[model samples]
Target: MLEALGLSTVNESVYRAMLTHPALDVAGLAAHLDLDPAQVHAALDVLADLALVRLDDTDGTARAVRPQTGLAALLAKVEADIAVRQQQIEAVRAAIADIAVTHEQHEVVLRLEGIDAVRDRLAELARTATTECLSFSPGGAQPADTLHAEAPLNAAALDRGVRIRNVYQDSFRNDPATLAHARRMATLGSESRTVPTLPMRLIIVDRSIALTPIDPREPRLGALELRSPGLVAGLLALFDQVWQQGSPFGEVPGARAGELTPQERALLQLFADGHTDESAARQLGISARSVQRLMNALTERLQASSRFQAGVEASRRGWI
Candidate 1:
């Protein structure tokens, strides 16, 4: 253990022998320890240099200093050495900070590959968001597990007083899971709206950083993170335009007595846009059978003989 304080094993042995037999000379210590006199003399020299042992020249005798004093001095020296190293580490960190900032500024666009990477980056952004968060959920009905995973992040942001504004595809209205998720978020003070179609999936935090899928059709591949001011501004503008056209998730606008409900109007628009029943159902977050039933109801209400006639009658009434 004394070796840790810079004492060699032989030096420690000699010092211990002196403490036990303060009158012993080097030759006596060597005989007691079964070491050569030359070896004992070398150990004595080291102990003397460390101030762990003292020699009386007139008497030619050696004795150990008090262990408390010797060990306390060693500890103080070790602490001083640690303090010097800490100062060096601080200097190095300060020198690297500017370089790190410069590199980050130069790298404006970052491409993150793989679903896990994208999700992790998004989670990090969400966790760090300060003022606000804007998001666009374009696809129809999202999986329940996906919404479940995202709920806590949204909840945490809301808890921090981060204003959250989300735009979801109109089809989400027909999805039970999505509706429940939206309701939960609304209760937590998040604002949400719905549009018939959305351009792409996006997330913007504090208008300073944005994330969008690299390919809207293949979101699982990866996403692009944008930090450039101009690019983020453009994306924010697009979001605002869509946000203006969307209706609040649970709001019901007043209509004339004979006017179509919002769902009916959306159905007519989807049909006029040439979307197939299957596609419409997917986009509306409903089953294909539900689409057929809605179509039948529309034809009956319009007093039309066919689906084409129903579209014509609906358009004539300004329902499309």
Candidate 2:
């Protein structure tokens, strides 16, 4: 009944038994619930992780925490996670506002109708970019066709000393083709990193010309090319901030003990912010089934019996 709160059926049953049969020992609770001793111990481990139950230091008996106390702390952490998405929204809104004002002035923004046109423009900019090229590549993995077409352009840019820097989604780590491409790009002097999410798919050349999709959520529609200094600068700053938070390409992030990958941590934050599996999957660019798979893996890795326990332990470890 309390499963929505991250509790499993066994966990809820165990917790309720503990509250009602306050004097019951481990064996007693197991007998009362018709569960084996092993199952009872497992549930207690999860309960302890959630701070829903504590081991009495002197007597070594398990005691249930009042729901008001334990659940409130979890709720407070959930509230704090609200800022993550808020920051992203405000950044995108500011960029849109800057683009709107410049777009009205005429001659600052150009509409590109198709992928071919966008590529032609990119080729032009790539050839002329004298200082540096910056881009935010969203979506999980690069399409094979797109990457094939882009490789030569990147090579040409590198050959001329136009520094190439890119920010890709953290999910790219799970794709072998993408990781291999990143490695090849790195050897050719490309500087790239991965962040959990990016506000838009953007490309800025020499910090002067910027190309951003008209609608980030549906980039296949088309894009807007902007040359206004104000608009470009805002987009550049956004890249800089996201880049600062990114893990450099080729590095294994959050591989250490008690840590979560940036993407994994971002998923947890969204879950805390009240997103369902489907909603979190949408934000994380994965299937809802994948979200469940990830949480199950996390639960096992943390030696937890339930998602609630894993999440709580992650918080205690400062992972979220």
Hey, what RMSD does candidate 1 come out at? 33.4
Once fitted onto the true fold, the runs of candidate 1 whose alpha carbons sit more than 4 angstroms away are 1-106, 252-255
Poorly placed runs, candidate 2 (over 4 Å): 1-101
lDDT of 1 by residue, 1-320 (tens): 67667777887888788888887776799999989987886676456546677545576356678888976887787789799999989987984564356437877678889778988887898899999999999766777766877899999999999999999977787677888999999999999998766778899999999989878878888987888788789999999998998889787433578887666777778877656689877666567897889888988988965565576568778787
Model 1 TM-score is 0.60
The per-residue C-alpha lDDT of model 2 at residue 49 equals 56
Worst 10 residues of 1 by lDDT: 95-104
lDDT of 1: 0.79
- Whole-model Cα lDDT per candidate? 0.79, 0.81
Most lDDT-accurate candidate: 2
Tens digits of per-residue lDDT for model 2, 284-319: 666789888988888898887555557666877888
Backbone-clash count (model 1):
0
